[model samples]
Target: MNYPFCIRCGWVLALTFASCYPGLAQTPTPARDTSFTVYSALAKARKTDPSITLARPAVPTIIRSRMNVPYCTASGRALQLDVFYPKARRQGGYPAVLLIHGGGWRSGDRSQHVPMAQQLAARGFVAVTAEYRLSTEAPYPAAVQDLKAAVRWMRANARTYRINPKQIATWGFSAGGQLAALVGTTNEETRFDSLACNIGYSSQVQAIVDVDGILAFIHPESGEGDDRKSTSAATYWFGSPKTERPDLWRQASALTYVGPHTPPTLFLNSSVDRMHAGRDDMMRQLSQFNIYHEVHTFPDAPHPFPLFNPWFSPTLDYTVAFLNKVFSRK
Candidate 1:
């Protein structure tokens, strides 16, 4: 029997790097001869572990294309965010998670992240997916502003969502990882704080999960080779090529933001991805600050293997454990 759950209400929310529509649960279509199948990972996992139960409760109510009130972007773009929560599980306030999707900040969808959000929700955390402005529509700080606004909106609506507000965490992939790191590091400054400050929301994240993201000017050999096609994501995010935008790149880099006050973080990288640079540098920074973090690297996997490879179930398993550990800290 499926247990019904409640839809959160009364909170004003924004989409930093999410969609304007309600979240949708999608099953991968069977297209023959494709390089990959959405079900391939799940199927492979179950084959190895027959005890796995793949069923998930239907999202009680998935919201879509809803505008974040008091839009935070300078373009006045009607930003949007999607929420997924269990209907039957409301005991006071719950832990909330924000997910940012990767597409070089040029192409990607909030729905692509719905499964991850659902996994968090099933494990008893409120999960949200966001959409941000792309380079085609706006450049650099535009997307950053949207991301900060989304965090602000969550804090603003904490009461309505039944979230603790203080327990919120963030996760992102690739370009989204950079934005997540930016949000994690830049809390007091309001580069996008046009919204009212009286509400008392800060863009700081309590913990962050960075997947296959760059952490320093130094790369892990893969991301350092070609200038044009290889490092395109970094080039676009920093608004200039790595050489021309050295200072700007460092400023946006998470490695530059470490401090005693920085939030705990978990990092994932693959040996094959060109963007895997700076994992060691990031570890050093974390050690210097004495900050808390966990690192996982897939030696033979391709870039983004964590998102696509089911062989490394440890990625999500460790992530859930880490979230519990950090969020429960009082």
Candidate 2:
């Protein structure tokens, strides 16, 4: 399979450097590339070389989510978000989409999702890439709480942002997908009050789009490190050993929140099975609930095919179509 050229370049550089330190004569190892990709979306996703970047869809305007606009506040730091919208205004404002980035719930920034938000904005949706606390920053439910607060913050200030609160949806990739699903399924049960921002607006989302996120984190065939208990993301993000906190682990799963009233969802997946543990079950549940849902599988694609070109167009099409249909019905 053809990979991004940037990855190939990184390998060449490493090999060249290795040859320079001939015979291991106590050569001091040069500094490692710090800003390279880590575990984003799926742990199996190949680490990207610095040059590779997501393709941006052309748009008339570029908007920032604003640096450190506290969706919620904590002793350490405040949560933030990035907003992207069309330059031309719509009559009744634009339908809002909150985008969440993936980094195995441990590492990632809202900046990674700007290209996607721009694409969505190009398609006429007011999109915001929401930031939440990482596992390193806090732990389970902290990220979830931050995301819920972000929704509330957006809805509470819909008029100022020219948003259609009734048509808001949560869209996330990989780990973010897991959070998005949680947000959609548990819309009826949980919501965090926006701190120092919107106080009373509801955090409920009308639709959801999960791009190859972990559907169930407690599966036997857990993807990353050796097993389920050892999987860095599943274990680290829970902030406990899986064996000791099975109940809490399950509670944190997106599939656990699935219920009769879960909003219409669109799931897109790569051919990889590592991250898509309980997709069939989630789909079955959605079908049984009679909720409008759709699933698409990209053949032989890697962990995050949606973020790049060639496949990005199709991915964007499915997302836009699903959002338009579901939001129109609402």
> Model 1 over residues 192-281: C-alpha lDDT tens digits?
555443247777679888877666644444352135333354443444565654676666666776777788898877664456466677
Per-residue lDDT tens digits for candidate 2, residues 68-126, read: 45566753566667777666767878889999887677666777677778788878888
* Per-prediction TM-score to the true structure, in the order listed: 0.73, 0.80
Model 1, residue 217: C-alpha shift (Å): 4.3
lDDT of 1: 0.61
Worst 10 residues of 1 by lDDT: 1-10
Highest TM-score against the true fold, candidate:
2
Candidate 2 similarity to native, TM-score: 0.80
C-alpha local distance difference test of each model: 0.61, 0.70
Local distance difference test, candidate 2: 0.70
Candidate 1 local Cα displacement, residue 308, angstroms? 2.8
Off by over 4 Å in 1: 1-74, 89-92, 192-200, 217-231, 309-313
